[model samples]
Target: MAQARENAVSEAPYYQGLAKSMMFTIALVSLAPLLGYALLSGYQYTTAYKEKVEAHLRELVLKHDQSVDSYLREKVAEVQVLGEVVGGDRLKAEAEITSLHNALVRSHGSDFVDLGIVNAAGVQVAYAGPYPLQGADYSNAEWFQAVKRRRVFVSDVIFGLRGVPHFIIALLVDVGGEQWVLKATLDFMAINDLVEDIRIGETGLAFITNRAAQFQTTPRRDMTGEVKLLHNILARGGEDSILGRGRAAITVVDDPVTGREVLFVTSPLKDGEWFMVYQQDTADAFAALYRIRNVGVAVLLLGTVCILAMAFLLSRRMARKVEVADQEKDMMNDQVVEAGKLASVGELAAGIAHEINNPVAIMVEEAGWVQDLLEEGLQKDDNEREVQRALTQIRSQGARCREITHKLLSFARKIDPTVERMCVNDLIREMAQFCEQRAKYANVRIETSLEDGVPQVEASQSEMQQVLLNLINNAIDAMDPGGGELDIMSRAEGGDVFISISDTGCGIPKANLQRIFDPFFTTKPVGKGTGLGLSIIYGIINKMGGDISVKSVVNKGTAFTIRLPASKEGMRCAAGNGAAGEQPPADGGRSEETGG
Candidate 1:
């Protein structure tokens, strides 16, 4: 018991290691492809989604850039047309300017906030609409100086004399050899509406800024904290620096104030004097991509959980089965030891038989001499007749002892493993009679019901002997302490020979029936059973193309049935050798029963 415990403890680590190895193998195989696909697909989708968003933002910024530029150019052209048609001489008149402004307002709505005429000295010479100053000073104004050098000029948004945020379009005119500036203030709210309408998802909005980083139009969101960041972006000198370029560019940067990554799409406007930029938070722009990524991670996590669970369960189960098989193997090794002992006992029996043979021969010769002496003294006397009878009895008993010694030597000799065709009924009768002495000692009854025409089987004689002996011994052991009947039967049916050995003994339980033939499985007490007998028998029969089965009822009896294919060659040999005898009566051949 202690040794068994030690062996079990030693094997625990081996089984645990096996289980762990299996678990890791299963997990790696299952998760490799899943993780690879998720990562690969995620990378591809992110790249595509980001490119799509950048393209869309770039297109949006460019479209609005054209609209804002067109609005500025149209205002400049209107001012230039007024200067040319009204002739700077008439423009000197305040009434003529007022009538022209009213006509322009009637034609273009409030987009034309007000109109004015400024001389080369930067002083307003004529004014129209809203403000009261007809001669507002303009000598120091930036537009006055710019207009003197350019035919048309669009100014950045500034709080001018009106103290309101607005920009103006001015056209220079030559009136009687004098330079005159025709200026019209554009409605700041009108241009601001153009940029305000360029809204996208949450946190996405557009605004316009000049090269000086001054806001030219109102932004939809607060821009107080982003002024420095915008200036730095305008100062950049790469493809995304669109300050003086005609094409739009895109960039992504971290917002210093919001501490979030932002996407910027910038386009040149108003002859590169201003920039139309559309900025949006990157998270908001790619919200759908992030959502899909989140869902994929969730699914991957769930798959990992399931894979681990199955791996653990299957590995543990397989490991348990392996442990059981190993234990059975150890038990089979013990049975091999038991078989070795039996072989030694057979050798001892052979030695005894050799010794007894000589003695029995000498005794038979001496008894023959005594009988001859009695015969020589043959007389019609009672003494002489008694001597003759006694001598006769001694000779007959000596012959019986010699015969038993010869049979013992034959049985104890080494077995031959050569395969041969042999009659099944003959082997059955031999094995039954061999066990008759043991049965008698146990007060058991032995019976035989063999069909006369049972066909011969082809198999190794020694293996067949072992199979029958083991089965008979098991039956005898089952009936120990209380003798029982042992029945042996043989029949030829369906091209096969059937043999059955039954015993009225303590039978096997239903639960153990299926495992009875398994190596190392036994209900017998420890030393009394090695548990390999039935398994070896099963294997031998299977090797000869035969099969065995069993049936039992607990507390009643057990029956083992064997089926072997009948040999056609053996049948032909029997016929050629004239060994085929007359068939028995139709009542199922011969039956015999003998009490121990």
Candidate 2:
């Protein structure tokens, strides 16, 4: 873990860049759709909501227009009935007209303000209720002229002699072959109430306007600036401005007065003489829509923040893991290079051993000849003792040289993977002997304990030899400079063969103990170690169905233990091969101690 942190620090820039790239990628992928959905859904909702509001306003104006028209027709019908029932004679009488006006007021609420009788000259001969102008001349009045042209006439709101806003509904009657107008004043406030009743959100109200853009009904608010704007709209719109479009026409324009966008719903009233209009500020109409949009934007922002945070953390963690893996890969590559160098050294040593073999054989032959000559003529005690001792030393040194060369040659041979029976004790003894000279040079002692009648294992002999050689060499190397004791032991118990090699040397630290068998992990100096010895040994043992473990204490010693399953077949085969069917040697179980 410490190593991993060091590596991360060393490659900080690389990991940081990786994290940044991943973070952006994650943010883009997450936010793109969210933003798109927000925009699309918001647009759709806004359009639909606006259409709904406008529709509601249009319907309200249309319904109120019909009500106003109906009110006017009822008043007209009442005037027509009075003229026909009372006849022109009674309608001209003040008392009769007063009785008719009172009856209208009682039956129809306050919709009717007064009643009057008009001659062909447009003179109001008789008037009843409220106003005191009993004989007003209407010879050129618009309603009087219009009523003469038609059987019934409902005038636009106007302030006639009484000087108040009201409209007159008049009926033309043929009384004794002469035309007279039966007129009734409709209450303007009654119609105004109908328009005023239309109320929606803030800034929503309705009013009635004539063709000249004159206000017929009292508006809820001042509409002086709106009147001129309406004049232009009605002028350009022509006769069917409101009716031709549909039941009601809707438009949105910036108000000249408020300088704010306003929605207008207009419908024709009284056969297009007046228009019922519903106006509202657009902002107020869509307040809920704008509110929902704001909330959605807030939620999107919050989600974006969460997505970015997660992306940053996740990317950083992933990059950290990648950095550690890269460090491990680099270490593995270095180990491979070291193993290659070790291979080259082994080839060089093999070549040197082959070259030295010829010369050593020639030297051995010369020593034998010298010994033969000394045995035949030398008789003096001092000279004979010296000559005999010298020859014995030469032969002994030559034999040692031959043994060393033979062992090197055997190790140089290619490994055989074929499984075969092998005695664990013998292999341990052989490795101990092979490392004995190196131990002597280091001044280290070699000790061996072999159990007699130990069970054999079935494995490749070359691989077993390699495993033992690696362990033994490591033990000798550990006890270098100032040598210590090296112990190799073998035993059989519980259906398994166990081999342990231990040495008293500068021990491995606890931090490195677990990683000792890992490839490319070593405590030795760079050039002196391949870091693959124990790892290779571990692989070989495990391949042959065996296990290997280690234990160490700093400045004390280290021990490696190997366990291989004992093969009963191999033991039986060994027994069958014994010479003359003799029992195995008793000395096999003995512990031998050798020192330099």
Question: Considering every candidate listed, which one attains the maximal TM-score?
Answer: 1
Candidate 2 lDDT, tens digit per residue, 1-596? Answer: 56446756878998899999998999899989999998899889989988887777777777788888897777777778888888877777899989999998999888889888888877788889798867889988888888888889888888988789888888998766779888889889988888899888989888888889999888888899888888866665554554576357877789999999988777777877788888889888888887888899899999999999999999999898888788777677545534643554473454455556655776677677667767776774566776666677777667656656665545444244456777767656655665565566678888887677778898766667767777777777787779999888777779898889899988788999989989878777887677787877887788678899999987789999999998867762232222211222232232221100
Candidate 2: misplaced stretches above 4 Å? 1-17, 232-244, 343-349, 352-596
Best by lDDT: 1
Model 1 stretches astray by more than 4 angstroms:
237-246, 332-596
lDDT of 1 by residue, 396-432 (tens): 7676565555444444442545567877775666566
In order, what lDDT does every prediction score?
A: 0.78, 0.77
Clashing pairs in 1: 122-138, 122-139
User: Which whole-number lDDT from 0 to 100 does residue 564 have in model 2?
Assistant: 93
